[model samples]
Target: MLPVEIKSILEKRAKDGWVPEHEAKEILKIAGVPLPKSAFAATRQQALEKAEEIGFPVAAKVVSVKIVHKSDVGGVEINIKDEKSLEKVWERFEKLEAFEGMVIDAMTPGMELFLGARDDEQFGPVVLLGLGGTAVEIYQDIAIRMAPLEKEDVLSMVRELKGARLITGYRGKPSVNLDALAKAVIAFSRLAMDMAGAFSSIDINPLMATPDGCAAVDARIIL
Candidate 1:
């Protein structure tokens, strides 16, 4: 059964064919997916408050239903070290068309990775893992498995990646916690299966993997 809050969001956006990034993250949180600390603010003051609450050196992005690729339109501002920078971001973002508010999140550092799920017509729900960030396309290294993945399945997907060594630690860099990552993947897969009919696809880019654990940095859900 879907959580009442998630069901409410889906019903409200049923006609839109997609869930906004902030709301998508909310759904992921409810599904037990780890995510960076974040909050939605509809005003500059609120943005500032949320930023302070989450601490400095955060990332703030414009939230709007019409804007899918935020960075393309200068809707993303990262490494906001203080209130002044956040205010500046607010002033600029407010000028954009269809501006709704801002989603302020703590800046997380780690190896970038991608996790996604799609409702495949022939195979039902499927999950994918890959090298993330801007190089995801350039690397073209990924692994996929059907939804409801077990811990072993998640580990296997990680191993199948050509850049799997990156996760296991490379050149003096510390290795990420594979156990935590597997738990996250299992949760994401379960979410995919739970929302199979309501969503067409789900993407979590830059799933930050660190020695401590993993966290979703950004996400999108298409209905």
Candidate 2:
């Protein structure tokens, strides 16, 4: 969950129309995200400079309050190898209708999943896990349960889905860190309760699962 201190950073950046390098960091500073170093910069120029300083092949994304699907609206730009790509992508990004602002940071490789939290009328805050990307809409293979579910429950959620086999080192791919994903799910559960006043729902699609850990690639918060 976002600490009271870093929550201010979230408010500060988004208010100034600057997207924080890591929204999750702002939301998870107290508990801490696995890789906070990758989180930095609040604007395209800021991110570009940081990327140049960090070196090539970084990623950039629009931090829009209005657009729930940033990719569909053409607000996401990735594998940005150099300053030249940033220049081109930035221009295209500016033209996006839902562009409130953007975030830029170092790129990391991993598998992807959808993690969501919402305050269900009957259940209060509930967490969801599923196969993400184009398959999320097509397959609808989801598992849902009440907030503060146990680690075993997280495993149960994964096992319950037919796509759960993907995380089990499928097709010669390495198995993912389901434990870390569970922690993130728990963290978001805490966040839902903590920020109940500021938000009504959240969707963290494409939560990247890497050898080191999980990272949220995209997220949406509805107030």
Candidate 3:
């Protein structure tokens, strides 16, 4: 059964809906996917409060129904170390006509990766994993599998990727928590299966992974 919060979001965005970043985070949260400590703010003061609450060195990005490419529209600012910095970034985001508040997230360092799922008319659900961030398309290093994945299945999917080495302490870089990553992948697959009817596509890019765990940094759902 789907969680009530997720069901509520799906119902609200049922028609001509695209899940916003904050709401997408909530959806992912229901799957028990680890996420950066975050809060949504509708005003500069609120953004400041969230920033302070989340802690210093946070990231803020505008949450707008109209702007799909936040970075392109100058709606994103990172490493905001203090209230003053957040205020400036918030002010800049406010200038955008489509401004609709922002999501304040704690800054976490990790190797960027991707996870996504789409309902295929013929295949039902297909899950995707890949190198994320600016290199997602550039590398095209991805793996695909059917939904309702088992632990072994997700582990195989990870090994199939050329970037698989990254999670195994590639080139002396720190390795991510493989068990945590596996759990997240399993949760995502279940989410894809559960929400197949309400969503056409679900994309989570830059799902940062470190020795501690993996966190879905940004996500979107098309209804």
Tell me, by TM-score, which candidate is best.
Answer: 1
- Runs of candidate 1 with Cα error greater than 4 angstroms are none
Q: List candidate 3 segments past 4 Å from native.
A: none
lDDT of 2 at 205: 69
Which ranking of candidates, highest lDDT first?
1, 3, 2
**TM-score of the candidate numbered 2?**
0.82
Q: Least accurate stretch of 10 residues (summed lDDT) in model 3?
A: 9-18
Model 2: pairs clashing at backbone N, Cα or C within 3 Å: 2-27
Each candidate structure's TM-score, on Cα atoms with residue i matched to residue i, is 0.97, 0.82, 0.96
Instruction: Please give the lDDT score at residue 52 for candidate 3.
Output: 83
> Worst ten-residue run, lDDT, model 1?
133-142
Per-residue C-alpha lDDT of model 3 across residues 1-223, encoded as one tens digit per residue: 8889999998887663799899999999988878889899998888888888899999998988888778888888889888888888988888886778999989978989899999999988889988889668889898999998888987898899987898778777877888888899889999999887778988888799889899998888988
Clashes of 2: 1
Residue-level lDDT tens digits of model 1 in 1-223 = 6889988999987887788889999999999999999999999899989999999999998998888878889988899999998999999999998899999999999999999999999999999999998677788899999998999999899899999999988899888999999999999999999888878998898899999999998998888
As for lDDT, the candidate ahead, 1 or 2, is 1
